[model samples]
Target chain A: MKKIKTANYDICFGIEGYAVLGQYLNEKKYSKIIILTDSNCNEHCLPHFLSNLPTHILFEIIEIEPGEEFKNLEIFTGILQTMTELEADRKSVMITVGGGVVSDLGGFVASVYMRGIDCINIPTTLLAMVDASVGGKTGVDLEGIKNCVGTFSMPRMVIVDTSYLETLNGRQIRAGYAEMLKHGLIYDAAYYDYLKDISNIDFEDLSLLIFHSVYIKNEIVSQDPEESGLRKILNFGHTVGHAIESYFLTQNNKNPLLHGEAVAVGMVIEAYISTQLSSFSKDDYEDIKKTIHNIYEKVQIQADDIEQILSWIKFDKKNYNGNIYSVLLSNKGKAEYDFLISKDLVIRGFKEYLK
Target chain B: MKKIKTANYDICFGIEGYAVLGQYLNEKKYSKIIILTDSNCNEHCLPHFLSNLPTHILFEIIEIEPGEEFKNLEIFTGILQTMTELEADRKSVMITVGGGVVSDLGGFVASVYMRGIDCINIPTTLLAMVDASVGGKTGVDLEGIKNCVGTFSMPRMVIVDTSYLETLNGRQIRAGYAEMLKHGLIYDAAYYDYLKDISNIDFEDLSLLIFHSVYIKNEIVSQDPEESGLRKILNFGHTVGHAIESYFLTQNNKNPLLHGEAVAVGMVIEAYISTQLSSFSKDDYEDIKKTIHNIYEKVQIQADDIEQILSWIKFDKKNYNGNIYSVLLSNKGKAEYDFLISKDLVIRGFKEYLK
Candidate 1:
């Protein structure tokens, strides 16, 4: 069992999953327990979760559709309404058990319901375990804008269990691997190199790698939780990546890219931009692109899509004083944010990615 | 000019109205300014506000209907959408000018829109100037539950100009006076005595009184911003007061009690409760009742309404671990919170109010 504590709360990984959770449940004084999950986790992992729990604990199950489509105000408001109708109060605890969608939505609901309530994250997917469960950023999308409305409210606990990873297929695994790869590329070169041969890595042996990724994220977040300065380093690829993700999700004919997949492509383009604008070595940029491309297939961004993506980027929360800001890697494992990237350079970066 | 500072921001009263605001506007760096107001303030106070501003500072005006009915999720969401449509970003500054409803709703919108934006409160009502502007408790009602969803985000500044009070009717002045009177009863005995002849006081001469009330509130809030412990004392009259306010507001046929009017009655009943359960003297209880009745008309709470009010109190955010807690005054100018008041005692207190 490994416990990494942040400034606010403790996050546990590689522990006996149900036992740790059962202990946590007994520790907190709650009137009722609510488990928020999606259809996927309810069927694939909930049974194992229930078997591991202390028996006779009173809890209610709230399951919703699985996907990014459910990450909106309507869904968030609906969950709040349900909790109210259920008479959930400050003493009520919500254990969100699913991927990024569930944790983000449920964490946000807990933050605003009667001001706030106790919430615990039992992340079921690799992406959620690595990213969503760490930072106190909780929010839902507004009018198709990703995370346009949210708050910075930390959960009481985050329990990461590797057993749930077994339920994910290759694509799901690859999607989560994208964040881990980016973590290494932006913060730890050696860790990035270690993940290069990820195909042959045993699933059981990746626990240490997951812990390293979470630790890197935690260190950055704890230093600057409000994203006023240092925390922007964590948004290395998210600027363009989020734009690509939202662009696809909003279009009827286009299939939305998974968060990690869009981020993977975003890193490639941002790396190219870094090499052009910053002291980032060309060799490092090429290496990052090659590693990410090897793990995740290239996502084709059409020439016409560039305009739409830039439009989305223009409104990014990170931008300030009417300037587009991007966090560029000056070297492997080192990033600096608040770089004013021009539209011409961004267009060139996208052109280079197309080539 | 008198300045009162809290943990997060500073509030100023008795300052040169437009000049102080003009200086505040000049001090902040904003791409554009947005003023959020209601119909009442737009018609009554905006002209004076505009006339006092430094010319060439561009701003947009967003107006909504006036009243407590506008304080809801639908209106909150609508304001957020409008800000997005207007491209109100992090650099945008929102100057909310109106009563408690405007400042509360606009402050909440500022807190949550694009995560948060800089907001300033230019309070037009006495109720707002004394209580709503200082606490940083910004929220809207949910399903008739008061402030069910909100956040504690402070504004950049709160500019309290008593000149706006000249536009208020007698009832508006009395409504806000209730909070000032409560502030005295709970935190300052001398201040309470000063307000005993509130009807004889002139609105133009009440600036120092407003300043004192705000100072008392600021002292208590700074000590306990989250209401985790000591801050609940500020809820002295609010427990029963809020229940009575909610009771009337939620009923269709009944005329709603202004926040202060309901709270005036709540203070009278709570004083009765205090006398029964604590060191409060019966003479003091009758004194509070007579003084309150002298200022505001009696609000009749039917016998049947006791059960409904109790139901509302059962879910107040301050309650924890399934116990309904009340902050009862032990004597004038001092309060103790987290007292577990039983239903039987609460009924007796209400029955005493009826008598």
Candidate 2:
């Protein structure tokens, strides 16, 4: 059992995570408990959660459609209205029991309801447990813009039980793994090197790796929770990655790339840019591309898609003063942020990724 | 000019407030400035505000319809969408120049835009200057639930210029005056005595009185920013007051009560509750009723409206554990909170208020 503590809340991994979560629910004496989950987790993970939850406190389960598409202002307002209808008072606590969409939207709703109530996150997906579980970031996408509306309200507790990871498919696990890989690529070369052997990641190895990834994220987030400076490093691949993700999600002509797949491709393109624009090694960029490509198949990006993606990049939350700022790797396990990336180089990076 | 400092920001009264505001804006170097105003303030006060704003920094004006009715989810999301369209970056600052509705909605928008941004509130109404100006509470209503969705994000600064009061009509001034009376009723007997001579409140007297109201509120809010304890005193009249306001707001049969007027009636009824339930004196309650009645006309509350208002009270944000919790006065300048109030007594108090 590993207990990782961030600035405001504590995270626990494995079965012990449930123990901590159950203990927290008992101590908080909340007026009632609300469990927010997506349809996917409602089917796969909720029964297990209810059985393990040791509180007799009245709990209600609210299920939304299971996908990023449902994460919008409309869904957020609907949940708030439902909570109101349920007469959920100020002291009520919401336990978000699913992946990132559930947690992000639930965390946001809980944070803003009555100017915030206590929330506990029990992330069921690998992507959520490894990435979204920490950092105190909660938001819903607005107008096809990802995370355009949000707040930095931490949950009362975060329970990252790895047993639920068994519920995820290989594609989903690899998508979450992309964040872990990017974490290592930017902060710890040795961790990256260890994770490079993409095949045969048994449950035990994945659990420890998830722990490492969360540790890396929390460490960065704690230093700059608002993403003022150090936290921007976490957006290393997300600059181009999020743009690509948004473009594909909105276009609907092709199947949308999962977050990690988009980010995996983003990391490769950024790494390529790093080699050309900064002191990053060409060999290292090639190595990163190879490792990510091993886990994620190459995404088909046509010329038109590139233009739309670049336009989305202009609205990247990380940018300031109308300039495109991208995080670049100076070397393996080290990154620099707020670099002025010209559209020319960004286009060239896309060209390199196409090859 | 009197400067009152709260936990996170400073509030200034009179002309010097503008000096502080101008200085802060020049120092922050925000990418852009977005001035948010309600329809009333946009027409009546914007030109004066723009002329006085001593900065060459680019600014855009976003206006919403003026009224508590407009303070809801649709408008909040609309402003956020407009912001996204304006390319309002995280570095942009929002200067809210209206009454409580504008400040509440705009402050919430700025706070949640990209998980928070800099916001400076320039409150343009007397009620706003004395009350809303100090509290970091920012929110928009959901489904007619007043301020149901919001945050505690403070402004970078607050500027209270009493000159704007000249633009308000007599009813508007009295409406705001009710909150100042609330500040006195709950915290300072001397201030209450001073304000009771309502007719002779010239500009100078109003300016100093507004300063006092803000000071008392700031002291209490600073001690308990999240309203876990001391801050609950601020909600003294708001229990019944808010219900009355909401009932009138949703029911178009009667003219909607301004926030302060609803609060004025709320304070009188709660004072009655205090005398019955706590150590409060009946004489003090009569004194409050007389003083309030002297300034405001009697509101006609039909028995049905009373029942509806009582039901609205059940959904009060101050509620906990499916119970109605109200702040009651023990005497003038003294109060207690989290007291469970019965429906029978609340109904009787409304009858007393009618009488």
Candidate 3:
């Protein structure tokens, strides 16, 4: 619970991260300690954090509005200007205290300021704790291009304190569970079995589960930090998942689907694709479809939605030179990456998903 | 000469870079080859480079306007859009075929596109050949903040073809020499002695000198790629030099001083500061002053310019909290970094330069 050392830095659990943060500040004696947070975290998580921090170093807060629209070059420039005004030199340590949006943009700010500076992540959501805070990928969107500019830079350490989950409603925490489900599906059948049919997720049990989920992600990232080969497996649900997420985001009538919900749907359909194209068991595909439907409300991908969804799927970043490449399941608890899938199979999967 | 091995990649000499590039293209068989340049390089250096490339690989060009005004996030985003349209995938190699502005922006494009792709620099300018091409410092200016967004990424190789220097004027080449003089002032006194009193620089000899200049920079850069300490010596003239450059940049009454002109003036003033604050020989400072004055037209810094220049100096990126740090001379050919010089000494150095 103290610290789990990975390829680049340690991932500290709960209050142990605070203890380590105190030690780190005392030893490094950075020119300044800057806290990068959003207005949401500043209101919700900051008080608990500041009271618990066992350090004498007075820190400064750089708070941005809590949303993705604010994550761009203009905001990036504003942060730099603030840092310049604060005289935050290369010796400054920027501790990001919020969810993925905060860390994604702030981590990038830390990485590029003066060609790079040190950063520590304090993930405040279940989703961020399990996924965004574990990996080194940090970037900001450009001209509406998502993560168009980024660098793979690890933080000095990651602090995942599950107590922050108390601030979130059920839907928010469940959105994080989607990534944990993907982690288990790809690596450990035993882990997947525990969560596959959960009638209720106990908060205390979920903390231990989040720890295991991060450990899985950290292990994969350590082996392939830059996503050359092994790391592509992590994109299993994201290819179709992101497309579905984008589709719903554009529609004004439908409520915005939580990322975990869209990804859950992606997993079911992709699991179907795996059985048809790869060595995945047909029975496993059928089981996934039923369980995912039972867990989350089914979104109708009607005949009209089919073509638009297919277009979105083909636009995956992994696609190259007119070929669509994907991470599909070869078997339960194992994932195969960079598999080229045809458009017909995708349409057929959507047809199957609809049925 | 074929190649000079640096810490990360080779600094290919003349046509040898093209030959190595041919072999690299065949060996790597990248997803695609993208040529990033400006209208200036596309018009001037592209044809000669194309004929000598010795490769069968059909490459596409991503050209932009040819000036610093065009080097910003809008341009950076446009290039990304063009690359996306071209299907320039992760395996694509972006060969920057121009001077610093092109390379600074293009190199950054290559480094960040798909979270970083392969980049090869083909520097067409003399200043870029010996300095920018040798070090992997690629970035874009943001909202008047110079190099506010960048990454310390090395190229696969640098193509330093001297034939491109034919397109430059005499002032352009001499501008490059100011940096060469700096290399000798910091790391090699013997190198300085060779160029100090040269009344006329033969083009043939200049090429050889440029090779040595790049070699010196690469040596210092390799030892400290991220500028922890040793690499700061490379900024010997740059601290005060940048201030002078910024000052003149604002004045519409005067023609823009070439970058080398500002740095030459900086080297003289800082050399004077060195003699006062450090163990530098006064005779060496006097020799540098007289020789530099003879080489470049001395730009007068009247009493009015002093306060503005002083303001710019304190704004040095190396300055932390409120202290001004610089790379000052400890001796001839020996530079000491992170030297804290008092304001009085800096003012005295300027007074000496004016005298």
Candidate 4:
């Protein structure tokens, strides 16, 4: 197991690491234990997770609906009621055992339950183990407003086991890889270079890359856990990426874009924005765009849709004092914040991504 | 202004202190501002609050239904949508302008908006200005649950204006006093003695008591912000008090008990429990009971209600590792934690309170 500690949070990554959950919990001596899971995890993932635990331990399980739709107040209240019914106390520990949706929702439930409680993240998906598990962000989306309600409560420890990835479909596995590539583009040029040559990799290799990405993320998060400074770099491609994700979501498209997929598109457009504002080298920018296009299927954006997406930029959480700020890359590994960009420039970048 | 700083939070209290909000928010330079209020404060309280602010500041006002009924997920989402439509940005500030209900709901909104943003409290009621405004605790109630969903994000600054209390009803004013009494019971014996002779005191003297109560609370919060140690003392009367409160709430009785009123009854009963188990003198317990009964009308808890309330005791936030731990006063100005009392003792305490 690899232990990564930041100023505000600490995370553990590896296989079979979940067995240590009871021991760490024993040390904290919480008055109660609550396990938060989505329906999918309860069926496919929990039995395997429970097999490693001692039978005598008494705890309650709160199962929420299975996807992003369940990550709202209605479901949040359900978990709160379950905790109250089970008599889970403030000294109790809440364990989130699922993917990004579960971690985000469960982390939020733990954050608000009695104004916050001790929480442990036992990520059961590749997407969660790599990206969402490292950050101290916990929240759920509101009506048409993604992640409109939430908090920043860090878990005491995060346990990641690669065995869960074996259960994921091919689409899920590919979706998870997109975020790993994002880590490489924003921070490590060498890691980006490594992903370019490979068409496919096993979970073992993916685990190693995930470990490195989490290490880099934890390092940045340690310096700025509240996303005040250094942490903004992590949003390199997320600005436009999130807008694209929301745009596609509203259309009732059958194949919903994965978070990483939206982020992948976000990276390309943001990289183009970086080139226009920071004068990043043309060759490096091309390489960044080409790498994403070559691996992920291209998403088409119409001119009118681009305008709508640009309007959504105003709602971006990063905007301060009404000015839209973008995290731009000066080079592969170097990022600059507070890069003021106008509507025309964003439209121009969108045209380039569409081309 | 009385400025009290603790390791986890800071409390600022005084009349006409709303201007201090500008200092903390100067760093972000917010564009548009949103102030959240309830129906009760909108008529008589908010105008006095707006008189102090600069006329040039751009802000929008959003009001919700007054009281605990509106403090739920439905209201939280409605406010979030309004903020989104108003184009509230990261640098946009949310000012909660009411009593505890408004502050708690507004604080929860600000905490989750864009994964957290800066918030300010302009508490109109005496209870909020003294207690809720000081601590970073922000939340809304779930289905029949009190403060079941929330976060602990500190406000930029708290504006305490005693001028608003001029319009407060007699019961509301008395409710705020009960919380002050709680501060004295847990931390200051001298303050408790001071309140003993307040039978004929004017409401103007409440400002001084508010300051002292806020100071004592800030001291204890600073020592243990997360409620890991000294903070437990703050829950002195809350365990059985909360159960009693929940019991009254679920029944939908004619006259719903206010938070402070239920707590007053809880303090009296818990003091009785302390007399039985700890070094607390029985005379001191009687004094506590008499002091509360003199100011507030008595709440009737039927004999049949004891078992139900006792069952709800398991849901207390203070429970740790499956044990129902109660915070009891050992003596005047002193508190103890993790007191394991039998079910019969609690039932007897309830029986005594009914008399």
User: Which is the leading candidate under lDDT?
Assistant: 2
Error of 2 at B52 (Å): 1.0
Q: Of models 1 and 4, which has the larger DockQ?
A: 4
If the candidates were sorted by their lDDT against the true structure, best first, what order would they fall in?
2, 1, 3, 4
lDDT of 2 by residue, A75-140 (tens): 999999999999998999999999889999999999999999988899998999988867889999
Q: Write the per-residue lDDT of candidate 4 for residues B186-303, one digit (tens) a residue.
A: 8899898898766756766777777788888878877777677778888888888878777777776545677788888889889999999999999999899889888889887777
Write out the backbone clash pairs for model 3: none
Q: Which stretches of candidate 1 lie over 4 Å from their true place?
A: A17-27, A54-57, B17-28, B55-57
- Between candidates 1 and 4, which one is better according to TM-score? 1
Off by over 4 Å in 4: A8-10, A54-56, A200-203, B1-16, B23-28
TM-score of each: 0.95, 0.99, 0.95, 0.94
Q: What range of 10 consecutive residues in model 3 chain A has the weakest lDDT sum?
A: A140-149
- Give lDDT tens digits, candidate 1, residues B1-355: 6788777777877546457667767777677788999988999999978876774567888998998878988888888888777777777899899999999899888877776788989999999999997888888877767788888888888888898998999999999999998898889998898899976687655888898899999889888887778988878888788888888889898888888887888888888989988999999998998898788877777878888888877667777656777889898988888778888888888887777
Residue A264 in candidate 1, Cα distance off native in Å: 1.3
Question: Under CAPRI classification, how is model 4 graded?
Answer: medium
**What are the per-residue Cα lDDT tens digits for candidate 3 across A1-355?**
6567996888999887788888888798777888999998999999989988888866899999976556676787688778767767778889999988789888888887877889999999888899887789887655444565678889998988988999988777877888888998899878887888767669888988998998899889888999989998888887788777767666666665776877888888789889988999999888878877777778777878777767666446676656788899987789989888887887788777778
Window of ten residues with lowest summed lDDT in model 3 chain B: B140-149
lDDT of 4 by residue, A138-243 (tens): 8877654566667777888888777788778876776777777877777888888887644766656887887888887777777788888788888878778777
The predictions' CA RMSDs to the true structure, in order, are 2.2, 1.0, 2.1, 2.3
- For model 2, what is the alpha-carbon lDDT of residue B48? 85
